[model samples]
Target: MARRGKKPKGRPVNGWVILDKPKGMGSTDAVAKIKWLYFAQKAGHAGTLDPLASGMLPIALGDATKTVPFVMDGRKVYRFSVRWGAETTTDDTEGPVTQTSEERPSRAAIEALLPDYTGEITQVPPAFSAIKIDGERAYDLAREGETVEIAARTVEVLRLEIVDQPDAETTVFEAECGKGTYVRAIARDLGRDLGCYGHVVELRRTSVGAFTEDDLVPLEALMEAAEEGRERLDAEAVEAGAKARVVDFAPLDDYVVAPETALAELYEVMLTDEQAARVLSGNPVILRGRDAPVFCEEAFATGHGRMIALGAIEEGAFKPKRVFGGRG
Candidate 1:
């Protein structure tokens, strides 16, 4: 017999859902769809993909939302196509073409130009972007026909390799970039640097953090599964054929990088069980680890009062920052 317990509704499912976002749907729309499907009380996405782009989008359900920032901070890889001789207002096919040229650079020219952008560089974001300027979104300002002058921010381009040169008019490339790097902006900048107008004709995120396209589930499959009584579906079966599918609870740790991974660069300060309990109760503890310089600070609980990990030392031992595994 099926185990009798609380129904799935409002019963938060911990960990992340790697969604293979479909094109033409907004990222938030996808999150809302998943939230409704899972009947989860809290849900958030680690990163946003443009409506024109598609691929892995990590959706954090329940307490996992607290760790979304860590996932977002991880590097991203993308496979994209940039069409030469055309510039768009939004740096993508969805936007209006503002300018065009007859000249198309050869693959050799494009490859040679890549070196100029292959390392740490400053990139000016597209005006029709989510970047905020003076308390307003740059896209909002651009929509209002207002001038939006955004400062160029430095971003690392770990790699930019030409995967395919279909023709002199278009170049297919793959890039691995740090957080806040924009592929659309890369398209725009590459065009400008090469003395030709360009915009991304196709873009697909291959990976975000440790999640990848191979781990995503199609939204349609998810919707169908939800309609077919999601609770009855085995977690393993749900993930069997999809890039993103429901994972078994036992392997939840595989999908979620423990919060401690965020503090890998920091010094370790293990605590006694009593010290951990005290930290859970909102008390600062002193750190006495000999591996690093001695310091003192308070470690406090983080995210929905779940004490699962310890915080950095300030005036105390690393205290319980998050707690997990209890009746919700």
Candidate 2:
């Protein structure tokens, strides 16, 4: 019989890749491609961007995967164009049009209605969404000809405004919102209120957490960089007579940001080597110095510039909630 518990392959590459995912590619596929390029043992993404949407998709490798929740919880910014006079089943261009109207909302009408969508408001997720229905995905059920009714949930929209009026048929909008705010839903709701049906014709996520356009590395650029890096590695291996398939990963390091980038919103506490050691072993350590925080709901500790743990500070002690790599 073949061994069942074989060790996983790939290098233990750790960090984030702020990928500018192109349209027509899903977030999972983007992460998988990145993982393959880096030859990472484990990989995940901070948030899911629909296959129909493009732009920033933060791919996390190895230890960086641990910080994904923090990034997911952070605010997201999206710029999208909505096609007036049409509503789609998926609330995006990928879906078939379910309703249409000849009427179109004027640019002034959209601007005036923006406030109603901003702040905390309730909205229903699209039928073709990742939301679960009776333990099955809503999209899966919807695809199987089953009706999916997602409950109305409150979402925080920090800002929603008309950015451009491309034509009478389309209007561009930019929104900054908390987790679970769907851009598609925003477009759909706006169209309904304006007496015209609408759906997202073009959607792009510009920012998530600390990740922004500045941090974006286009998919093609990454592939090109990987090709060069892999070629160099292969040549070095041949010249040195090293064992084949060795992944140095140093050449591609320049493209990856540190894992701590996801925790930018959290307080950082620099620890002594001894304290770091204790934290890695899942122990709490007393923080000293006059400037030390007496209490923090969430904080990350680093020693020698390496992440040690993410935890809370309570009564002058930092408690390790999630420990990272062994003490460096």
Candidate lDDT scores, in order, read 0.73, 0.89
Q: What is the lDDT of candidate 2?
A: 0.89
Q: How well is each residue in 1-328 modelled by candidate 1, as lDDT tens digits?
A: 9878765456556667788888898999999987866766788998889888989888888767766776788888999999999999999887799988887887878889788787898998889888888889898899999988989999998999899988888899999999889989998988887788899999999888767667777777666665444235567866785334343333332344334333333444555666555555655566554663345342323333333444455443454455444322
Model 2 spans > 4 angstroms off: 1-7, 232-248
Best model per TM-score: 2
lDDT measured at residue 300 in model 1 versus the true structure, 0 to 100: 28
The candidate that achieves the highest lDDT relative to the unseen native structure: 2
TM-score of structure candidate 1? 0.76
Candidate 2: residue 119 lDDT (0-100)? 95
TM-score: model 2 vs. ground truth: 0.92
How well is each residue in 1-328 modelled by candidate 2, as lDDT tens digits? Answer: 8768778798877889999999999888888888988888999998899998989999999889889999999999999999999999899988898999999888888888988899999999999888888899899999999888899999999999888897899998899999998989999999999999999988999999988899999988876676655434477677888644424556567889999988988999899888888899898999999899899999999986788788999999999888887632
Query: Which RMSD does model 1 reach against the true structure?
Result: 7.7
Residue 173 Cα positional deviation in candidate 2, in Å, after optimal superposition: 0.2
